[model samples]
Target: MGAPLSAWPWENLGIFKYMLYGPFVGRVMYEIFYEEEKDWKFSWCLQLLILSAVRGLVYLFWNCYTNSLFLTRNRQILKQGVDFKQIDKEWDWDNFLILQTIFASMAYYMFPFLQNLPTWNSKGVIAALIFHVGISEPLYYWVHKKFHGDYLFTNYHSLHHSSPVPQSLTAGHGTVLEHMFLSLVIGIPILGASLMGYGSISMIYGYILIFDFLRSLGHCNVEFIPHNLFETFPFMRYIMYTPTYHTLHHTEKDCNFCLFMPLFDALGNTLSSKSWELHKSYSAGNDSRVPEFVFLAHIVDITSAMHGQCCLRTFASLPFRTRFFLIPFFPFAVIGVSAMWLWSKTFLFSFYYLRDRLHQTWVVPRCGFMYFLPFATEGINKHIEQAILTADKIGVKVISLAALNKNESLNGGGKLFVDKHPNLRVRVVHGNTLTAAVILDEIPKDATEVFLTGATSKLGRAIALYLCQKKVKVLMLTLSTERFEKVQKEAPLEYQSYLVQVTKYQAAQHCKTWIVGKWITPREQNWAPRGTHFHQFVVPPIFAFRRDCTYGDLAAMRLPKDVEGLGCCEYTMDRGVVHACHAGGIVHMLEGWTHHEVGAIDVDRIDVVWKAAMKHDLRPLSSGSTIKAN
Candidate 1:
């Protein structure tokens, strides 16, 4: 809810709200291509749009930079993470820029003195500064203070205050009326300069760009401003507000109301006593909390690399997919790959809190295709090893290897690390034990026999052994007779007959339960009976080719209800849900387990880990499939 007229008309338009500039842009295009002599106003309008885009890039740069845990961990002012609400509220953050451009264009025609001008104006810069210091500062200060009062706070100002942990875009997130007033505040300097015959295009560009830069700096939530500078010149603190100063205003709500200067707050007696103190503490590198658990994941593909939390928030929040809008960003993805390969180290991807425990996802900086390259194995292993060593150095209790990070062929399900560092205090976990558990538990109790693919793989072997013990027949699909016979010999002598070896997909035609651990094509999928349910542990899950047969999502579990600040999804999983391996690592952390759960799946610990996961409130998916199959 907001005050009357506070909301923009296109608030519900999403990305299409930018269409408001279409008419102006179309006119500009007409002037460039169709007209012999361009109207100065059209050129100015085009410049304003271009400047707005540049400022937009400025904001995006800060947002991505501040979101990186590797870069801004110690300088982060707020420990609480941003949620979807903040992301939604700031979606139309550039609305004010568009409004100002439109209003400025209208004013160009309305005022006779504001016609064409030169590119640069030195005198105009001085006049703009005077107008800003003498007028805009005082005007914004008083108006901002007034907005904090009861009625205004509820209807209008509360929208800006809604985000306690501000980002670069938070500077522009407010009601339309607030933005209108801001336009006036911004306009006074330029309008005053124009009246005095000192206005020029450069004056407008410099002043507005500086204004946006300061606003972004204050709200970026990273305290990069050094305290020593304020110590050297104490007066500078009154002239400029740091990220910490603005953070105080958001958190405390009654003080530090000035736009980009604290001098007004000092004069008005609203300056918080703790503002400078908190800033000093943050800038001095005080907030350095170590994560309790880490999930060491690697990039899946080039397309999936674009789904990084810091790269594209909206895309990362949903299931991973090939999107039309992502086409323009393909070059960026390629650059990211090249940059990572050149730099080549583990980096923080995302993080959240669960029951006061911090859990972070760290990427191994290699894509799935790169992992398959024979020459890339050593580099991948080195990155993974460095991450493990770093976690151990930082006192992280548990670190889980995810997806390809724990591939049997690559590192023997993370066994290589555990063996290399025998003195390691940090537990190395593959999390496949719980993955096997989740897949087995998803099968209906009435299921008597199951057809298995990738039957010789790590998870496949565990599932087959477990099911055979329960007298459930397992049709192991593998071409290697030696591997099949070895697995059969491991099963109890009495239950050995339950583990049957069938080398082809056609053998599973009579079976209704098909457990897939390998990617199957649509041609191979046709072998499943109409009612067959494909419970899978395959990466890039098998396609749902049959309308009559249901397909379960890759083994996953819903996070506990008490988990905090989980604003993004994990790969293709739904909100607040994670792959079973991720949950398994979390379970390991929560249970205070000390064993390194790597190498091979311990059949005895599968039920133990599953029970512990359930005890800690992690749950198996109720439906399995995102969409139903009849």
Candidate 2:
């Protein structure tokens, strides 16, 4: 169904809709700049904006808190995770607050009674509560029941119901008309008290804060309220609704439409018979689902750190790009980094399902630059070790180390952990075997000679050995001839001649097939022939500087279509695709391999892992295609 006429005019503006507050902001600015004395109305407007900001932070805190696996374990009401559709649908959850601000501004101009309100009125609190309980509750109940009727249900109410598994934002998600009704239901209590000379700034703030608190509590999808509380004081159930109570309204629809009170639903005979039972079940902490697979990841940079699913769902769903709005938060990000460095440990990042198995991603609180800092290696390894131990204790089947977490220098690509805990049942995987495989699969089969950069590195060494065995001449690029000879000797004597050491880019000027395992400058890239394709396995992938040559993405694979609940992208990869190492870990889990894939890449298992990946329908994204960079 199309959006109703009551939809917000600036709904399509997305995050930029906050700019609507500009005029109110300008009013306060003008009063401060030009006038020695400010109008009370203008000052109140500023207070409203500040209050809205604080309320927004409250919602954000709840969102992150509920999503924290450790804190909310077994307390989650819905098993299903939010998808990109729900994220986009609820992106403008603060629109209602903005609308309320606009309404308050209009009412001040229209009614002279609202001016010069006192800072606090104890009687106003009593009046506001009475008005809310006696008037707003019943009015909202009837309006909600009516909206479920044929015309309104189809055209308006369905948008809110679209999210069966709700978050805090879901409480504010509805049609503009729906919010208009909500504003009146909520506003009348405050305004009525004001007109009767019982309204105060404290009363307004307290009433709205409680209103939002209850609304968010009902929609957060976490069963934090203890069942014993309701059992002890049975009357409290009629007074307040739990998250489980409101979830039934979305899932079971037709029943439990009351706002904040089950008493309304009880009176209307619309309350679900199972509401109490479900609440008890959720509050008892019985539905914990531990993931079988976890991909251990670390932040690549300051900008990449903000691309977390919890930080910004909309931004994380797409390939990452630097947004102008993010610039304002750079100082806060620096503080967060400092905090993480000092006190943070491994935490759950995101999760999804594939073939009835739970797959999670965990993050180590360190940036890419931190990995290179000599002093930070011990700290980073400690976080990783703790994560592995925790996963093992929880009976996790597999945990894959991503990117710099598996650095050869740090822990010999995770060999340190596995060796340190030899009795550990949980399989640790570097997933680099499949990374080498994906990069190798991208090279043309007919090409006899290939120029290799970073030839002495792990994947590079494996690649040189594997290619030489196939009779492909590998011009190994390295300054250290000793390192080149060391990797070359790994191949059979017959293939050793095929792996030749070369120190400079000029050695590959005639070579058309280039396998890049290191970051190369525009000048280094120019050495390859005009028609050459660059296959890479480097971090932050090499820049595509030459328009004449086609550049390949870092090794990655499209996950099988059977996957579900995947809302956010993995760094810069597309929606359903993930880094080859991430996919490799998935394959490791799906194949039920008992071995730990650590240390150097296994040259023999390259084909085996590649074939297993293919068997599971994880297609290589870089194969048979060329990416031309401008």
Candidate 3:
């Protein structure tokens, strides 16, 4: 059986028509406009410079106007005004123009490289252009991919990626090496056509103008292409690249490598998953508001098929010395085992778009089973870094680390991430402020005494101090008596008497309200009194509690009926509670503040953040519905 006609290379016909006819039109227009010019060299140089400047200025104006309109349409208020500091840092117009002039002057000197053909013919020009495209596609793909590597990216390509919401002027705002590489890529095609003795001076100049225009359009940050054009003539998509296509390449460096055409990208299997949908939405002129912030959480599952549970179980069974010996091999083993399950496994990172009436957010989940394993610190940290990098690539303004991710990253709150990835322009937040607010809201108004487990831990200590400051007696319980005593002493002299330090679980019976600050096993849950109201902070709450006990994960608590949950965490508890950390970050983003509220949760700021969160009508997930960590 043969393939259908639709499967054939009919798309190439569009490329042929544009390449052949475009240059022919340019030739006729040039002769009519510049027939009197005797010095071909000087005339060509002047024409190239004028065209480049005019195209750059026009696109620059268009980019600025559209971006301003987009902000107004989406109701995005820039709290800090325009990020001129960032623009100044990323854009070196003086240096860029200098390099451009040098490149143009050099090209003027190398005019001999362009072989003047004896006659202009449609068939010859088309054949030459086809050959030029075919040769340039693969070369550009590999070089472009090379720029994505760590060394090259940091040293050269990072400048290009600096403009997340890219303007047309950003097209030429790259490092010397980056611009040099681009020059070669653009020149190779024209040089090839010239060397083939098939294109005239006018034809060559026409090709340059077209290339420059397309390059500017690709970086314009506005989608002007018609959506239905691709649907009506499906083959055109493969032949012509749209603005959305190149924007994705800038945001997501892993895909869409082809410059002028998507042929290489399709063949290389590097197209982004959201590319087509983004194209459709942008092309349709839909109000596709870009994400201002993203929240990152790992899906916590001990028994899921893709979580490497079997390996975790085996690792748990190994002796201490054997486990230590196998530690180095764990990553390699994981890679080998994961390859077999790759087809069935969900991606390591997945994106979800969420919005409420007042706000919009992006939630990204990192997939892994080792998050629960105490010894898998390195593995967990690596995954968190990956999620951060991914969020940065997508131009997320702020990223909040959820649950276990906060713990592994030094609960430095989010400072560790900021320090580690200094180059990642996005801000890192632990979302702990909102978590603290939610937990505080749940505390019984009449209860003067409260039992706080993991009192020496970060969140536990913070909550204990908060309770003591409010004149509610806090029964601080922890395995470390020394740490417990230290925390008690650190309290203000006036509030010290309200801090009750306990080193034993049995002492928790003295308090009616129990707050579990850390992840507890079933055995640990038994220590709580029979009818205590338990506010749990950890995820997948310890469910096997006494029948009389009322339990809820305080951090995941949702707001009242009037408030809407903005899809922070994936799961909901008994009432419509969301993860407090996720909600806190959302509140911050909504307020347009870039504060990193991880370990530094303040008692005074809780009410402010809480009121803002309540405005959105944030609710908890329905009971029994499974949500992955946001």
Candidate 4:
């Protein structure tokens, strides 16, 4: 059986018609207005000069923003070895700086003679601008292949190609020869159109500079295109020239010739089918396929710095926005200032409440954390020892079984004392069978504090579940906002609400959280079975007893330290969960946690707090342990 005929072929055929017929139609109109100007020398020069200078400025500023994002997100923000060192070196032989100046200056000198031409009418003027963008870009595209030929690429184009990760600055990166050749691409058609009376000097050259910014933007390394902008429309999606389109050009060196649209490349069939596929998938390039950058948890730190700066200014006798003109911008100003308030309310409270009891600056590492094994680091050997030491003032003696060597540091250590305090011996147990037998042998018959810690991994989650199965009031601590959200949605109503109220202070700092119990309400059965992504959730109560829950959530000592808050209740967002709307949400449960069949919370629905509360019909989870604060 043969493959079905493809629609892409038909689509290419239509583009071919547009490309071939477009310039011919343009040239026909040019012949109608052909006229000789008495003096053309100075005007042509002046127009070209202004065009280049203005475009260069726009390109420079845009490049700055795009470059900063690429470098910062990639952790190249601080600059690295050999490649970075080479950046400061000047290789201005390829500098387009002189070329832009030369062109803009020449245009200024030539405008007088070029401007008074009889063909400089508004219609012809617009056509001249149209012709500059319309033809020069296609010409560059059609000829870029030959430019990348062995001879030209090695000396002329290779300099620009050096920025495989091209920034906006890289847009103008070409050898002196390439810079010279670029002018011809615009000038030849432009001058010919002028000789044929197409349009005037001013509009034609002005459009050329605009094309510069377009190409510069097209070459930006960052993926700034909002997917929603183009995806909803069928025709526009394919037509838009994405950063991917230009990036693919740098990679293969064969397909990037056309820049304006697929009009040239699609019709010519020179565009990479692979590029198109990636564009459709929205991956852009493999380099851009990075883990998410979490600005939510980070916002608190940035805001703190900004607020401090503002306060300092005020203390020094300067108001933030005292000028009259700044009044109208107050709404935007308020939003800018309110970043702290928004983060604290929305993410701070929820996420920190889920991550930990300490308000620390938490960083979510890229790549899965599954590969890390439990081990020693930074003076903490047995995790239980550390927990014991932390609670030692109260006469607690803890032992850890983490020495069995299956778990990693943070993952193991956090789990051993999660929501629990140490008073007895803890032994490290590895392998599923060994851990089960050990648990069967010695259960904490009179454990005073029962809590769960560790990652949502097979080993860690299992340990927590085992504690939960013993009817131990487990303290569940999730690392990512995504995990916290999943657990909250999956847990029974009481557990869910208790998590919120208990962790509010912790959630306030880092947008990550740590809640300390699992009491399956009827609400859990309803929400959990529906699959744990999102559901209508009520805000958990603020007080978990007579104590302010925020104060209690922060009372834990060993949590990661926050950028601000000086070691108070802190949390860190798992960068992995920045945009649930965009990111893949597969939950990574602790290795041992899933296997035990500890049973899930039972709930079919939750209409209100009282309905779920009535279903709970038991003392609040924290009521048993919480003593009235002094």
C-alpha RMSD by candidate, in order? 2.7, 3.0, 21.8, 22.9
Computed on alpha carbons, the lDDT of every model, listed in order, comes to 0.87, 0.86, 0.59, 0.37
Residue 61, model 3, lDDT? 50
lDDT of 3 by residue, 1-630 (tens): 222221112223532422323443464467657886654444554555555555555555544443433133222111111123334543343244444545655665677744334335454457546755877667788888898999887777776787655556667666667666666766666666666656565555566657667777777666778879989999888888877888888777789988878878889898787777788876666454445666665544312222221222212212212235455555655564455334322222112223432323322233345555667666556556766776678676777777667774433566677777668766787877666666766776667888887677767777787788778888887667688778887778899899887777778765668888766665666777778878777554667557777877456645445333211124333323446777777667767776556455665676677677766666433233211112
What are the per-residue Cα lDDT tens digits for candidate 1 across 1-630?
A: 546967887878888888988987887888888887766453866886888888787787777777777678778888767766667667678887778778888888888777776777799999999999999999999999889999888888898998868988888888888888999999999999989989998888889889888889999899999999999999999999999999999999999999998999999999999988888899998766999999998888888888876787656777787899899989999998788878877888788889999889899889898778889899899999999999999899999999999888899999999999999989999899999988888877767899999998999999999999887999999999999998899888999999999988999999999999989999999998898889999887888889999988888999988887676788888888999999999999999999999987998788899889888999888634321111
TM-score against truth, every candidate? 0.96, 0.94, 0.45, 0.38
> Clashes in each model (backbone N, CA, C under 3 Å)?
0, 0, 15, 72
Question: What TM-score should be assigned to candidate 3?
Answer: 0.45
Count residue pairs with overlapping backbones in model 4: 72
Clashing pairs in 1: none
Better of 3 and 4 by TM-score: 3
| Candidate 2: pairs in clash | none
RMSD of 1: 2.7
Give the best candidate by TM-score: 1
| lDDT leaderboard ranking | 1, 2, 3, 4
lDDT of 4 by residue, 1-630 (tens): 212221112233532423433443444444434534423333333334344456656665554444332222332211111122123221221145445445544653464443445534456555555665577767777667777889767656666777535555567655555666677775654555555565564546455666676777676555556555555775664456766677788778788467667657777788777755556544322333211111112222222222111122111122122345445545653564455334322111111211222111111111112223333232222322343343334231221122122233443423444335333232222223222222222323454223333324443344343444444454444546676555545444544443321222222232212222222233322322121111110112123321112212211112112211121111221211111100101010111122111112111211121122222221111222221111
lDDT of 4 at 8: 17
